[model samples]
Target: LNGFRRTPRPLIRAEYQHWAVYVGEGHVIHLAPPCDLMVALSFYFFLYNVRATVKKGKLYVVVGNNDYRINNILDEKYEPRPIQEIVQDAHGLLGKELPYSVLTRHCEHFVTELRYGKPQSCQVQLR
Candidate 1:
């Protein structure tokens, strides 16, 4: 926990954020980026797709929690996915390379894809 910090583009004032997927043990899977934060933030309109990787006990400084899916279960619009399949799908991606993108395939997209079977990000207009 000491060395593992939040891993994401530190755009605290920006509209987008990153979340890590805890894949059991002491490891976490997050997008490591094909480019740096300066490049992504300096050129806001440019498209970037990075490679997702598994980092053992590593995270960057990030804020906020994804409670909508976990706490919004009482909502009628919240359709929960099966935990067994989600876990299975998540584990299945442990050692594989994944396509990561800022707008199209972000950290939120990874979480949604694993838990809900569809990758979705709300921070950026996907279209």
Candidate 2:
């Protein structure tokens, strides 16, 4: 699979998996914590009145180009959509602001949605 390394916080390393869809040519699309002003500002205003810290995120289409090493792949029991459709779906989300929730919507959910046409997070389900 083409994705980011599953580098969680040291204390919770085994508790999560960051996922991304392999869109060919060493590129992948995944949701991640906000890394720039456009996303941070949007989430800040969106959560203005909320008591929780505004840690918003967005979807990124990155050209990893062998930055990550391949490990074993988990075979999810769903048939993936056509490669072209999945690639299109992933590309369609590039740079979009997304409401990210560890327990509801995360990286795994993003990739699964593109591949299987349904959002599902194994990490959340196992919790």
* Whole-model lDDT values for every prediction: 0.49, 0.52
Give the 10-residue window scoring lowest on summed lDDT in candidate 1: 66-75
Question: Model 2's lDDT to the true fold?
Answer: 0.52
Candidate 1 regions exceeding 4 Å error are 1-9, 12-15, 23-28, 34-45, 54-78, 125-127
Per-residue lDDT of candidate 1, residues 26-124 (tens digit): 445554444556336433665454566633333222223422111222124444466556556666666666666666766667766665556665556
Clashes of 2: 0
Give the TM-scores of the predictions, in the order they appear.
0.58, 0.60
User: Candidate 1 at 83: error in angstroms?
Assistant: 1.7
Candidate 1 clashes between residue pairs 3 or more apart in a chain or in different chains: 5-59, 5-60, 6-59, 6-60, 7-60
Q: Pick the candidate with the highest lDDT.
A: 2
Query: Which segments of model 2 are wrong by more than 4 Å?
Result: 1-15, 35-76
